[model samples]
Target: MWPPRRSGGGDVKHCYARGHRDSGLVSGSSHVRSDMGDIGFKLKVLRRIGIIQPTSPARGLKAAKALRTWGPGFPSGVAATAARFPQQTAIHDDAGDITWGELKADIDRYTQALKDRGVGPGVSVAVLQRNHRYLVMTLVAVMQAGGRLLLLNTMASSSQLTELTKREGAELAVIDSEFLEVAKNIPRESIVLAWADDDAPDDLPTVASISADMPSDPHDKPEKSGQIIIFTSGTTGLPKGARREEPKDLKPLLAYFGAIPYRGNSTVVLAAPLFHSWGLINFGFGLSTAPTYVLRRKFSPEQVLKDIETYRARVLVVVPLMIQRLVDASSEAIEKRDVSSLEITASSGSALAGDLANHFMDLFTDSVYNFYGATETGWVTIASPEDLRAAPGTAGRPPWRTTVKILDENGKELPQGETGVIHVGNDMPFGGYTDGNSKSFADGLMHTGDLGYFDEDGRLFVAGRDDDMIISGGENVFPRELEDALIEHPAISDVVVTGVDDPDWGQALAAYVVVKDGQEIDADGVIAHAREHVARFAVPRKVTFLDELPRNPTGKVMKRELPDPA
Candidate 1:
């Protein structure tokens, strides 16, 4: 262990930190056990999921000690994983492969460098980089130094970044050199380049430069763990920064393991944006599972096929749009790769349309798991491949230890099969937005701002955004229902239904569709399909054909960019 430095503040521990109780750090025992049922369940789930394997008694013991030394949260995950699996491949990026030991070495060096820059408990550090090894190191470093991590979206505008950096009060901003122009106006003094250019000045700070000068001694264990902040989906407006700390209860881990079969140490190609909560969840989960992550700065459907074959990846993590693009890729492109090693293909970040899910499953294995939740609500539900196959578009039931309720505007609980706003209760609840804004909560459950209902099998079927509910021809209608129906048509590969102004009806539905390749279907066919699938009033009045739909990074439709109905 590195020589201990004094914590600036006295050792003030949060009662919620499970590291003290069950990390096996405090006890120095080979077998990590806890009296608390939650922590015990955590270990059980980890072991059950092949995360806490009996590799070597000595290594396991070392891992426990490392966790104790690093305190709770992301820091401990890095340290403990390194101790247990030093030679194991941890990260695979464009920079090539890095072992767990190598990653820990880099993170260990930067943790001190980060602390020297006045980053610790309650301190804030903003990161603006894509998915890469540098991004991973910076994440662990900030957390090790006990600083709250503000994850900025790569798609944010310069003005947005400037306003956000200033409003969030970020003292330091770490950015990729490629994004230098975008981050130029961000109010920050300590700007560290994440990915620098070859011709960059030697004096300028970069992750590689500071990591090279890493101090031999590790920073002192933080008195408290750091927090993670992700932004809300800004499809409609400016995204708000939603913050959260690691859940005090380990039960949430069980819920994750129960829903998604991400085995420990498996190779996975994660194409989802790391700045989002969906990607962040797997990133955090990998701390214990220690999966080999194959990352690319930018996603490419063609490159993903090659990456999977090259790495023999067992799991493929993606957003729905990526999946759609993959499915749309030429038959020759997909036929060339040996992606048979894939056991799980998980989808998150946005809704995975039922028909799209079915088409994806038809091509690949029936191993799709579409996660449904928002930044404000932590993992509200998970739909397994079976759930998707049987129920099609139904969001699977809440996993272990999570509760979901349908509530009316007055906060009254609605019965099953009744449409209402979605409210969620989970161990990892949202800590509200960084600007002191928060989601509506009812009796301690947070509102999801979505309208959905429970089916006979207790599955959730989201109608659409609660605010998107429209009245057409004096009849209440939901665009999602119509879009869902239209997407099922074989000729149509993609569709989006929205409320458009109409002289005939105060509001009418308008659909923008992308016809499947080699198909000769026309607007009349689409209208006929919708008419057959949905109610008369819910049918889209206007059908506009498009080559493709505008989408955000996470596969969410950018409805704001849609053209007004002709």
Candidate 2:
């Protein structure tokens, strides 16, 4: 939604909302706030974002009734968006585009098709595909049909996929056409194709094909909303399934709106894989605001710039790695495109290094939002551009309705400027691991499994993972501080510090450095750079130069893949 236009010769599309206004309050959220200021805050946010407008009262009633039938979640949100703004563009993928009305109809048909195939309530369904139109449809339709959703990483191997399918008890496996060969190993009788190309097998069963021949089946609303499971990054161990409970209030929505200035009915280019928590969260926002999402099955730095120019997008959801690639491609390809339409580059899913954030903002617009969180707990802290400029590498402050604490090993609170464990309490709390494992907590706050300290200005700075801390010669060395120092070198582009066993010191530092292109640097220079910036004990005893550090799908360094110290 845009500002009101003058009475001139220009066409303006009006973005409006109805549901909360139907409930008499502008926020349509059920809250027991006694303070009038608290009530007024949400009302202003809704109105500024075009969610509260002068519209028909009956339309608001219909929007409210649509959510009542589907229950609250992505399914209900999409249904409500369709009820209020059916003509609004909801999705724009590589194949084509679809309106809210068309998307809702397709989802409803597919929901019936799924229910007929015994994908009833509590049944588990696994989805494996890149970001695409059908993939989004199948995910929402499964939720509407009352099936527990297991989102699979597209980069997983045949063995991992097979193991995950059997381990999660996913009765059905919906795969893209390219991965049909890998699907053979999933060991599921109800294997369905999410999408297929021209050369796909003739007997392939797709969601479209299945829905085309399916009968109209009417069913009552589900007694309970289905659970959504996002697997952990298998860096530490085997991937564990983590489910999120159904939201109790509009706190999550209000919290996001309060921090990130998201507009209604805008265009967003999602470069991040939709299977991950970060991408899926943005997808949820797109549904609520009815943004025209531009999705590509694969990610390319150059292609992403092109998409931004083509779509004139307002927001871009991605991991930090994509920003690095964009910067790397700046001279070669990205500089040619007019990508100034981007207003917010909301990065999550992996660590957003301080240097990378500033470099990106310098090259592009000053719109980098460094989101610090995990798959278990969403958006712990968001560093705005102002926060990043004021204090680089700082995770900024917690958003609304969020609590963050730095606690010592004994579960006691740590004062500011003291590094300790990070515990958080927010609307997007974890629903425990599916394997019955859960994160440790203290005083109603979930332990984030991270080490960090708060600055004098209340900014959070994550030192590193708790396990990544090294005790070399009885001196504690945090790799993040050293890595941040080394990345500032003019010749170095990236670096990662880790602990290595040493006979001299109980444990030693090993730094993997990625030198900038056309620059020459060896172990001596790298060691000198480290020694100048960090303590002698924190300096790397061994330096290994690499073209690039290996990373997982979500841009996390796969430390296990690093070679043994030479």
Candidate 3:
């Protein structure tokens, strides 16, 4: 069980007051003490979340400083880290390792080049590239140049890219040469290629030429921090751009990083796509922690393990699918590699199936942590290894100063163990979508569009998306419960459950399955297996075998693309 919460007392106030003083944010004068009551409450919350240690004054001071300095955005953090750790290795990619000082130089050069192209505050610059050092540099440079960063998914089609860039009003697109054709819809002059080869097309200019003559001095900071417009997965339809501003308060940021145990001098191998929120958050954390970041343009499970062993990486940031791939790697291959250096494995982006979670922890020590959140609401809950071991499917408890509630269609709160739309209230909920539409917000909580319930232990368990719910013969069903049961079968490699049209039942469950190699399972066998674990109504009425399920770049199953049973 988790530790019990401490009672309210003057000791909490004293701890926060000392923390504030040590941080150099506040003086130890009577004037500061007059407001210690409110500051103390905030500190108490942070303490309860395990961000601030009760006995470690140095850790408290360091966390306080990190929170205080997080507001000026990416450029400021990069510059600060460079000044503090000039010789430290900041990023390692296919090209070579780059130090903090070298990283800042590259960012400054690109910032100057972008400024020369009239990119500044309010200007939207779309970046279309795979994971690499150039991509990282471009993101920082755009933020430094005071331009709104429009992150484009590399897996999107030409038409999808055209529509998104046009709708988002992007004036310039910095892309890899390979993706230049896909981004042809953008004006020729507006497109600048970054990762071009010797035989690159002659029509467009390259980022190399643009920055070759530019100075490495800092570019002017924007009056207001530029926004980062991250698009939704667009699994069902056109993706929406979720807008975020540089966070002003660092309390929530501190709480999250502190709870996750990301420390200074740590080495991290990031496997998730840079465009997604999970990868982006880890990038932000990297800047503050000044970790040695190992980057790869594409994900290969074996390569990820190799990088961990090569770099002695302590943490691996990934999505759930990446974890599955790692687990699926042959036992012989996994045994030959030395992954003993790994201390933590952070997973988000999608649901971490309970079976996958347990298998991963069993293979690699009990250091796996599953975080639950969406692009719109930020992070809401985190399931530690112990949480997964105790309650296999729980999403864990909310962090400090964050609240989670289950609400019905009428906006009334639901009791524990009753599934409803999950609503979250946090310090850093997204401002709104770029298109002016917003999710339902009542009181202070924002609707997450996820259907879930809290167990008796206050752990969150997501059933499925509210929109993904199916009414079959007047009995509502969620695909997650059935999918979870089906995945437990040894023959199942990967599986996704969806509701298809049915005559007798209003809608019927269909399972798209990818069977494991050397294993055989037919549609009838799948249904029979599910029947043993779940109710008859919950069993999939049809099962279609496939080489693999269609997935977006972030590894989410594309339900709309699943084929109908013959």
lDDT tens string, model 1, 1-566? 10111111122111100012223322111244345755666667788666567879888887788766754467778878888888989888988899989888888888888787788887888898999999999888898787889998898889888888788889888888878788878643578888786765466688887778776465667787788888777887888889876756446676788678777788989889888888888888756777789999988888998988998898898998899889889999888987888888888887777578888878767878989888878787788888898888767767655667677888987643456777887777678888888888995678888877765556676777878888877766778778777777778888888898889888989999999888878778888887787777777788988888887789788787888775
lDDT of 1: 0.77
Total clashing residue pairs per candidate?
0, 1, 0
Clashing pairs in 1: none
Compute the lDDT of residue 505 as modeled in candidate 3: 88
Tens digit of lDDT per residue, candidate 3, span 322-424?
9989999988768777888887898899888757888987887677888889888987788788888888876776765566666778787654335677777
Instruction: Return the top candidate by TM-score.
Output: 2
The residue pairs that clash in candidate 2, if any, are: 20-28
lDDT of 1 at 388: 90
* TM-score, candidate number 3: 0.88
CA lDDT of each candidate? 0.77, 0.77, 0.76
Clashes counted in candidate 3 amount to 0
Which tens-of-lDDT digit does each residue in 159-220 have in candidate 2?
88888888889998888988887777765457888878788887767889888865433335
Candidate 1 scores a C-alpha RMSD against the true structure in Å of 10.9
RMSD of 3: 8.3
Question: Candidate 3: which stretches are off by over 4 Å?
Answer: 1-70
